[model samples]
Target: MESAPAQPGTAEWYLAEASKLRLTPLDDKDADPTQDPKFQERQRKIVDLATKSVALTHKNPEKKQQFEVSARYLLDARLQLAMTGDDEQVELLYENARAFVKRDPASHAAAHGAHTLVNLAYHNATQEKAPDKAATWRSEFAQLANHYLQTFPREEPRSVPLAYTAGRLCEQHGQIDDARACYTQIVQFTPDSLHGSEAERILRRLDLVGNPPPISGPTLEGET
Candidate 1:
């Protein structure tokens, strides 16, 4: 028999009972109704339970409850690591991310798990200023990027970051027009996101070097 829905708090017992649910339709209104995109609830529970088990400190979770949420998948965790100047932690974050990808090899949800892998593994080749350590993991990074490109969603209520990442990869490949489409999508989809400044830089870098063309979308409130 299926179990009852877990309450928000004190559901650690329930959350710990992990099960693999892959190939699930993202559009189904009933799809993983309990799944939070950022896994905040399980994370909160894990932090709360940290004192109880020496192994559940974000990296390790008891088998029954696999909070196995990679730091990359948890924006808050990544931000904390950045604040603490923990590059090693960031690397561990990628390792955890890879594990999530492995856990559900056929999952579309596993797509973003590849995000950190690309961001860290190929930040240089794809980003504007290539880094010094270009040789660290080029082949593996390229393979991951290709895999992401193959599975990327075309339409989304929030695809700015997705488009931006695609543009970066195009920039590396010298596909100026392909990159332009991706950046244009970024400006079109989520102009107000944290990527605004970076997106603007990219638009100009792609040769839209003058004043930005007037954007036509639902204007933000208070903007005449």
Candidate 2:
């Protein structure tokens, strides 16, 4: 069982330690380290403290920064834990992350929502427990990825990753056209970059190139 919430310092230490623990293949291990009963209880303690920190600090913008970071980490831990077994908690975590993203779009908090959704989608898709849930997560991930790309400045450094994620999510959701658009945006934004190259590869694989743009822009290998 989780211990009582500690003060910020102790809570931070515990959360940090938990993050550092290495996870092995599930079949080889007795349990996911994060979902080990002892670890879960310990993480719950940190979550309690982190929740308290957010409530106490949210009104003060400067102070809110630290606790907001804590809140994201705590919720991420819970999301990971929920994915180990409980679908209901997984939904709850999704809501919490979504609420945080809506409340603070510019902050890094929003990315956690995307990350959690992607993880859940991967879990449900590969585990074969709930195909509907998997579909929902993929749809949600695509929506969030598109939203992030639209909301952020195209030239922003984060846009590159967002574009890459959007491309993958769109592809996974069978929005092939949108995936092509995302990959094309990546190439346009950063032609020589790794993500651009990867996007080009996917475009080639998908045979997304058509009669060409007529202006004769950059062409991936094997493109018409």
Candidate 3:
């Protein structure tokens, strides 16, 4: 016999409902779908379902997988809403990420949440015109990067890219000390890798007042 469907209030039901509401193709590629009533309505439903699923699985240890899945969906839905230029959703995304990381610091979803924050920081810095907001995002990015580094070991694959991004952003914003700290971590952890080599070059450049000399090596004939 076939099994019955998940009950309406259960986590599985919410996830199923959310999965059913896929975005359809738009007639105009350049048109902003977020402005369409149908699109907005669908997004709202998705956000609602994802939020409910997270709540349902919050304290259920046996439902840890479901919780992570719900958190991912929640963040994704919030990100979509935030892309509509909704400040509320953007703030909620930050809150959601923080909460998720706090609840499951070592989970893949937590890492993704941190990465999402980094993306938001980049968007605010490059795309938005508000300086104060951009600064706030940068600060948050630095904080998240530090937190990730502290939480995950250097051997973790995600660590290197996060360190690189954090270092570059810090250097760009004149946080030389913070940048050096990040780059130093990369160099110490993986000195032979591409990121480590690049980090070493950056550290060398930072040590000088002006641009450092070009990197040269001996050719086959031993010519400099």
Find the candidate with the highest lDDT and give its number. Answer: 3
Candidate models: Cα lDDT each: 0.47, 0.63, 0.77
Q: What tens digits encode model 1's per-residue C-alpha lDDT throughout 1-224?
A: 99876553333433332211112233445534224443334444433343232133334334323343322225333423422324665575566556656666444325556655555545444332444444333434545544554455442433445556666766676566666666665565556766656776788776754655678766678464
Q: lDDT value for candidate 3? A: 0.77
Give the per-residue lDDT digits (tens) of candidate 3, residues 53-164.
Answer: 9998988999988888888777777777776678898899889888887887777677777767666665565555677766666666666665565566632477678778
In angstroms, how far off is 109's CA in candidate 2?
2.7
Runs of candidate 3 with Cα error greater than 4 angstroms are: 23-40, 153-159, 169-178, 210-224
Ranking by TM-score: 3, 2, 1
Error of 1 at 203 (Å): 15
| Residue pairs in clash, model 2 | none
lDDT of 2 by residue, 1-224 (tens): 99765454553444444444423123435666555776666556656655655566555676656656766766766766676677677777778777777778666666656655655554554454565765655555555454555555433466578668767866876778767787887777677989889988998878834544445655687555
Candidate 2 lDDT score at position 154: 38
Clashes of each: 2, 0, 0
Please say which candidate is ahead in lDDT: 1 or 3.
3
